[model samples]
Target chain A: MSKFLLATLLLHIPLYIYPILRLCYWAESPLWLTLLIFIPLVSSQYMSRFYLRKKNSVWTKLLRRFADFYLGVSPVLLISTLLAEIFVGFHMVTFGTAVTSVIAITVILGIVATMAALSPMVKTITLSSGKLTAPVRFVQITDVHIGSRKPAFLDRVVHIVNELKPDFLCITGDLIDGQGVSEDDLKSFKSVVGPIYFTIGNHEKYEGVEAIARRLENLGVKVLRNAETHFTKELQVIGIDDMDDANQVAVQLEKQTLDKDAFVLLLYHRPRGLKAAADAGVDLMLSGHTHNGQIMPFNLVVNRVFDMIKGLYEHAETKLYVSQGTGTWGPIMRLGTRSEITLFEISPAQESLFPSR
Target chain B: MSWLDEGADVRSTSLTEEFTIDLYRETYQDRFIPLFVVESSGRLRVVTDKADIPADCKIISLIKSDNI
Candidate 1:
C-alpha cells in the first residue's frame, strides 16, 4: 500500500474502533452486537475511498452515503464518548447515565451540524486600488464539490449569487469531486446573469480535468488554463492550473505579461505564493482550497499546512482573499467553521491627476 | 468595408477590412471582439487599415460584442 493509504488506514481504523468499543462497554452490549457494529464501521472507511471511483454504481452510491453519514457522526460519537468516560471517572455520573448523555448530545449536535452545512452564508468584502478605474462587483464560490453535493445545493448557491447582481462570478476550484457530473448538476450555472470563470483544483484533476473543463465550458463558463482574459480596460483576470509544487504560482506568473497600470485579479485554487503574486503586480488573488479544515480541531492541523487559513491578507501591493468554502468536502458536517460565498466590491482609490470640477 | 489579403504588406497600405476581420477571428476567436481598438499614440478609430495600425499600438480586449 502507498504511504498515504497506509497512514489513512492506520489513523482512521483506531478512530473507528475506539468509539464503538467504548460505547459498547458503557452500554453493556453483547459481543455479537459489538462485532456486528465494528466490522462495517472499519470496512466502510476503506471501502468508501475505493468504491467512490465507481461513482454512479448503486453499490458505490449506497456505500458513499453510509460512509458519509458515519464520518459526519463519528467525531461527535468519539468526542462525546471520551467526555462521558472522563465524567464517569470523576464520579459525576454513572456508566449508564454517561453513555445515555453522550448519545443524546451526539445526536442533537450531529443534526445541528448537518443543517449548518446545508445553508451557506454570504460574506462581503470591499477592496480599493489606485489602478482601478471604476467600481467592480463580483461573487466567488469555491469548493462547491457538485458531485458530492446535489444540484439543488448548487441551485441555491446560484440563486444567491444572482440576487447579489454581481458583475461576474468566479469559481476558484474543487467544483466537482466525482466523475460523470451530469449536465443537470451544472445546468443552473447558465441562469447566472454574469460571466463565470473557473480555475481547476486538485479535485478536478482527480475527476478528470478534460471532462470537467469540457462540461463547464459547454455550460458557458470560461475555464482559465494557465491563461488570462481581459475584463475591462482597467482590469484583467488571470488563472493558472492548480499544482502541488509550492512554487507553481510563481512559475506560472512568470509566463504572463502583467499590466502594471491595470488592476490584475488572479484566481488560483490554493492560497499560496502571496509574495509571488505581489511581485507579479497582481492586485488581488482569490482562492479556496483549505476549506478552513471544514471541521474544528482539524482547522488546527490545516493551519499547520497553510500560512493563511481563512479571510483576507495583504502582502505588498497584492491582496489575497481565501474563502472558507461554499460547501462541505468529505462528510456533510461543519463545526467551528462556516460555509461561505464571498462577494467583493472593488473600487478605484481616491486619487486623480485631474482636480474635481 | 474592404478586405486586404493575408499576405498584403501592412507597412504601406492602411489596415484592410479583411485584415481586421482576420485579426478579430484569429486573435480573439469567436468569443471576444474588440469594440474599440486603441492605438499607442492615444488615437482612437472605429475602423482602420493595416497601415494605420501604429507601430507602438497594442490590442487590448474590451467587453464582448453582442453581435459576435
Candidate 2:
C-alpha cells in the first residue's frame, strides 16, 4: 500500500477498534467479541467502496447504506470513547459509567450530524462594484458529488436554485464523484431556468473527464474548459480547468484575456492563484473543492492547505468565495460544518453623492 | 502614409474562443498587441487582451505608423 493509504489505515483502524474494545471490556464481554469488532472495523472502509460500486440491487444498497452509516458514526464513537478514557484516567468516573456516557453521547451526536447533512443551508451574499453597470444574480452549487448522492438530492437542489431565480447557475466542480453518473441522473437540471456553466473538478477527472464533459453538455450545461463566455456587456464569466500543477492557473490565464472594464467572474475549482487572477483583472473568483474540510478537526487540516476555506475573502482587487460544498462526499455526515448553496447578487455600486434624491 | 491591408489574412478555426484568441496573439506577435476590438454591433472597447473580446466580436488589427 502507498504510504498515505498505510497511514490512513493505521490511524483509522485504531480509532475504530479501541472504542469497541473499551465498550466491550467495560460490559464484561468475551475477548472474542473484540476480534469480531476488529475484523469488520478494519474491513469496513474497503467494503464500503466495494458495495458502492455494485449495481443498485437491494442487497448492495442496504450494505452500502450500512457501511456508510458505520463510517459516519465511527468518528463520533471514537472521539467519545477517547474522552471516556481520559475521564477514567483522571479517576472522574468508573469504567462502566464512562463507557455508557460515551455510547449515549456518540448516538445523539451521530443523529444530529446525519440530519444536518441531509438538509443543506442556503448562504446569500451580495457584492457591489462601481464597474458593474448592471445587476447579475448567480446561484453557485459546488461539489454536489451526484453519484454518491442520488438524483433525488439533485432534484431538491435544482428546485432550490430555481426558487432563487438566479440569472444563471454555476457548478464549480465535483458535480459527480463516480463513473456511473448517467444522463438520467442529470435530468432534473433541465428544470432550472437560464444557462448553467460548469468547470471540471478533480473528482470529474477521476470519473473520466471526457465522458463527464459530454454528459454535462448533453444535459445543457456548458462546460468551461479554460474558456470564457459573455453574459452581457457589463459581465463576463471565465472558467479554468482544475490542474494538479501549481502554475496551471497562471498558464491558463496567460492564454485568455480578461475584460478589465467589465465585472469578470471566474469559476475555478479550487481557491488558488488569487494574485494571478487579480493581475489579470478578474473581479470575483468562485470555488468549492475544499468543502471546508467537510467535518470538524479535518477543517483544521484543510485550513492548513487553503487560506480561504469557506466564505468571501478579498485578495488585492479580486474577491474569492469558496463554498462548503453542496453535497457530502462520503459517510453522508457533516459535523461542525454545513453543506451549503451560495447565492451571489452582484450589482453596480451607487455613485450618487446625495441621499434620498 | 500607405495603410497596410486592413483585411490581412482573417482565418477561422474550430477552436474555443480563448484558444482562438491565443492563436491570433501568437500569429501576430507584438503587432497584435494593443488592438481595439469591437462588439458584434460595432461598439469599440479597450480590453486587457484579445481573449477579452466577446466571442462574437471582430478583432481589428491596428498598427502605429512609426512602429509596425
Q: Could you give candidate 1's fraction of true interface contacts?
A: 0.00
Please give, for residues A1-357, the per-residue lDDT of candidate 1 as tens digits. 899888777667546888888888888999999999889888886777784556578887788878877777777787888888789999999888987887788788877877888989999998898888789999999999987887899999999999999999999999999767786688898888767878889998888776676667657677676666766768778877888989978977775667777889999999998999999889999999998988766788899999998999999978999999999888887888899999999987897789789
Task: Determine which window of 10 residues in candidate 1 chain A has minimal summed lDDT.
Answer: A209-218
The lDDT leader among the candidates is 1
Local distance difference test, per candidate? Answer: 0.77, 0.76
Tell me the tens digit of each residue's lDDT in model 2 across A1-357. 899789777867556767777788877778787788667766776776764475677776666667777777777788888888888899999988987898788778878888988898999999999888778899999999987888899999999999999998999999999657788888888887777878889998888776776666556676676766666767777888888867767777765667777888899999888888888888999998888887666788899988889989887988989999999887777889999989999888997788775
Candidate 2 iRMSD, 1 decimal? 15.8
TM-score of each: 0.82, 0.81
Interface RMSD of each: 12.2, 15.8
- Candidate 1 RMSD to the correct structure: 8.4
Clashing pairs in 2: none
**Candidate 1 residue spans exceeding 4 A from truth:** A55-59, A352-357, B1-68
Q: Which stretches of candidate 2 lie over 4 Å from their true place?
A: A50-56, A352-357, B1-68
